[model samples]
Target chain A: MKFNILIFTHATATHYPMNYLASIGSYAIMVREVFKKPTKWRIMKSLILKEIDDLIFGSLGIIIFISFFIGGVVAIQTALNISNPLIPRNLIGFATRQSVILEFAPTFTSIIMAGKVGSYITSSIGTMRVTEQIDALEVMGVNSLNYLVFPKIVAMFFYPFAVAIAMYIGILGGWIAGVFGGFSSSADFVEGLQLDFIPYHVTYSFIKSVVFAFVIATVPSYHGYYMKGGALEVGKAATVSFVWTSVVIIILNYVLTQLMLG
Target chain B: MIEVKDLHKAFDGSPVLKGISTVFEKGKTNLIIGQSGSGKTVFMKCLLGLIIPDSGTICYEGQIYSQLTPEQQRDLRQEMGMVFQGSALFDSMTVEGNVMFPLEMFARQSRSEMQDRVEFVLRRVNLADAHKKYPAEISGGMQKRVAIARAIVMNPKYLFCDEPNSGLDPRTAILIDNLIQEITREYNITTVINTHDMNSVMEIGEKIVFLKDGIKEWEGTNRDIFRTDNEAVSNFVYSSELFKKVRQMYLEERD
Candidate 1:
C-alpha cells in the first residue's frame, strides 16, 4: 500500500508540469489564431465597440470604489507609521503618490479586473464553446478566435483610461484622508503631491496597464475558447482563468517594473 | 453532392468513426441516424471539416477536404451553413441580428438590402413576428426557426443540421423537418442532417445512412427502410412499442 501510494504521488507530481506545458503551448497557438485572418473591419468595429462597453465602461464603478478606499487606507497607514516630527507632514502625500501611481492603480486594479473582466470573458466564451456556438461560427467560415478575442484585445486599449481614472481618484482620496484625518494639513499634502512628480512614473504605469490589459483579455479568452464539457466546466474555466490572469499580471508587473524602473 | 470515402476518426485512441463511406446527393434531405453513441455527431463534424478524419477523404463537390489549402477550406465553408443541436443562437443578438449575422460577415450589401434579406429569410422560416425578441425570450421551436433562418440567410449551397429537432415537440419537430426539406429543395442544397428522431427519418429522409458502432450499417431511402429486413435497423427503427405496432399496421395495410 505504501509503495502504491508513493507511485501515485509520483505520477501526480509529474503530470502537473506536463499539463502546464501543454496549456502554455496551446495558449501560444491560440494567440497565433487570434491574429490570423481577422473578420471584416466593419463587423470587427461593432464587436470592439461592444467589448469596450462590456469590459471597460462597465467596470468604472468598481474601479472607482476600490481605488478611493485603498488610497485613503494607504494615506492613513503612511501617516501613522511616521513617528518622527522631522519627517515632513507632506511626506504622507509623497507616500500615497508613490503607492497609488507606481503599484495600486496599475497592478492592483488589474488583479481586481482579472476577477471581473476575466471571468466575464471566460464564462461567455466558454458558454459559447459549450453550446457549439463557436462551432456555428466555424461552420459559417468565421474565424472564431479572431472574431471573439481580437475585439477583446482592441477593447482593452481603453483599459489604460480606466487605470488613469483610478490614479486620479486615488490621489484625490489620499488628499481627503490626509487632510481630514488630521495627519497633515491640506496645503502640505497638495504640495507634496505636486513635488518631485516624475512624468516617467506615470508613463511606466500606462505601459504596465497596456501589457496587463493584453494579459487580462487573452488569458481569459484562451480559457473560454478552448474549454470543453458543459455549463459546469464554464464556471470552472472562469475560476481558472481568473487565477492565471492574476498570476500573469503579478509576474509581468515584477518583470516590467524591473525593466522600466530598475 | 458530398462524397465521403472510408472516413475514419478516433478520439484519445478510441475510434469513434471506423471507416465509413457514403454519398449525399444535392437537393435532397440526407439523414444520418443511429443510437446515441453510434458516432453520428462525429461523422457530421468530420464532413463539416470541424473534425479532421484520421484517414480517408471527404470531397465536397469533388474538391477533397484534406487536400484543400486553408484559404480554400475557408472559401468552401462560406458556401456551407450549419444548424447546431442546441440552436446555438447568439444570445446577445435578437432574431433579426442573428439572421443578419452571416450577411454582415460575408455579404457586401447596403443596409437596406441586408435588412431585406434578413426579413425574407426570417419570414421564410415563419418567424416574421419574432424579429425583435432575443433567443431567450422565444420558445424552443421558435429558437430552432431562428437557427434555421440564420443558417439559410447566406443562401448556402450546402446545409448541415445537427439534431435540429432534438428538443422540440413532435409537431414542431415535423414543422422544422419540413422547413429544412423545403429550403433544401428551393435552394438545391446538398443537405445533411444528423439526427436520432425516427419521425424525421420517416418524414423527410430522402436518403438515410444508418450507423452502428461507428460503421455504416445500412444505407437506403425512407421507402427502403420500411421494407428492409436488417435486424439492427429494424430493432432501432421499431424500438418503441408504438412504432412497432405502427410498422405492423403499415406493412399489413400495404399487403
Candidate 2:
C-alpha cells in the first residue's frame, strides 16, 4: 500500500504543473470574459440571484435536515459518555468550533452542493454543447467563453460561499443540541466557544469556500463545455465533475491547512 | 462573397478535407452538398475558422483568414450567423433571451432596443408567444425556428446553415428552406448551406458544390446540375428509385 501510494504521489507530481498552469489560465480567461459582457452590476445581479437560489436549495436544505439527525445522535452519544471528572467540561465547544470551520463547512457543504450546483453546471453546459448553442454563440460574434462560463464563475463564487455559511450555522445547531441542550452546562459551553473562537479561523473558512467556489465553477464548466458523445455523455460529464471536484477540494483543504497552520 | 482556395484538413492522421476551392456567392443560397463523410461540414467549419485548414487560404470577401492574426480572425468571424443542425438553443434561457444574447454581448444596444430586436426576429420566425418558453418547453420545429431567429437577429453579413432540415418533418423542412431563402434574398446575405437533401437542392440552390471522398466532384446550380452529363453526379442523383423514374420521363420527353 505504501509503495502504491508513493507511485500515485509521483504520478500526481508529474501531472500537477499542467493542471496548475491550465487552471490559472482558465481563471485569467474567466476574468477577461467578465469584462467582455455588460457592466458588473447586471452580471452581479444575475449571479447573486442564482447563487441565493442554489444555496437555499442545496446546502441550506441539506444542512437543516442532516443537522437535526446528526445533532440528535451526537447529543445522545455525548450525554452517555461524558462521565470523566478531570476532563475540561468546555472541551466539547472547542471541538465543535474546529469541526465546523475546518471540516463540516467545506466538506459537507460541498457534498450537498454536488447534487445542487455542480450537477447543474454540468448538465446545463453539457446540454448547451450537445445542442450546439455554444457554436451559435461563436457564430453570433459573442465570445462563447465569456457568455457561457463567466456568469457561472461569478455565480459560483457567491453560491458556495453562501453554502459554507449555512454549513457553519448547521454545525452550530449540532453543537447547541449536543453540547448544551442535551449534555453539558450551557454557560460552560458558550464561554468555551467564545474563548477559543478567533477571527482568523472565520477568515480561513471563508477563504477556503471562495477557492472551492472557483474549483466548482471552473472544473464542472470545463467538463460540460468539452463534453462529447450524446445523451449519455451529459450524465457521465456530471458524474466525472462531481468526483474530480470532490477530490480536488479535499487536497486543496489539506494544502490550505498546512499554510494557515505553519 | 467567401472564397475558399486549396483548403485541407486532417484529424489524427487521416485527411478529411482535400484541396477544396469554391466561392460561396452573396445574395444567393450557395450550397455545399455531399453524402455523409464527404467532408462538407468540415469544409464549412474550415470556412468559419472553427477547424483550421492544414495549408490553404480562406478569404472572407477580401480578407485572407490564414494570414490574419487570431484576434483579427475572431473579429471577422463575428460577422457570421449560423443555424446549427440541432437548433442549438440555450436550455436555461427562454427563446427571447437566446435571441437577445448576441446583442447583449456584442452590440452596445440598450436593454429595450435588444428586447425590441428579439421580439422582431421572434415574430419574423412566427415565434412571438414562444419567446417566453424555455428551449425544453418548445417543440423541435419551434426550437429550430428560435435557432433561426437567434441566427438572423444580428442581421449577419454571412449566414451558414449545417443540415438545417435534419430531424425536421417534411412540411417543416420546406418552411425552414423558404425562410432561409427569403432571408438570404431579403438581406442579400452570403448564405452557405451544407446538405445532401434533394428537396433543398431543387428549392434554393442557386450555386452548388458537390463533394465525394473529400474532393470536389462537381460544382453547378440546381437547374444546371440536372442537365449536366457528369457520370458521378448522375449516379448519385439518379440512384434513388423516384429519381430513376423521373429520369425515364425526362428521357422520354427528350426523345
Best by DockQ: 1
Q: Which ten contiguous residues of candidate 1 chain B have the minimum total lDDT?
A: B45-54
Candidate 1 global lDDT: 0.90
What is each candidate's DockQ, to 2 decimals? 0.46, 0.44
Off-target runs (Cα >4 Å) in candidate 2 are: A1-48, A55-58, A67-83, A159-164, A179-181, B110-116, B251-255
> Model 1's DockQ?
0.46
Every model's Cα RMSD, please? 4.9, 5.7
CAPRI quality band, candidate 1: acceptable
**What TM-score does chain B get in every candidate?**
0.98, 0.95
Fraction of true contacts retained by every candidate, in order, equals 0.74, 0.52
Candidate 1, B82-123: lDDT as tens digits? 999999999999999999999998898999999999999988
Q: What is the TM-score of chain B in candidate 2?
A: 0.95
Cα TM-score of candidate 2:
0.87
Please give each candidate's TM-score.
0.95, 0.87
- Could you tell me which 10 consecutive residues in candidate 2 chain A have the lowest summed lDDT? A1-10
Interface RMSD of 2: 9.1
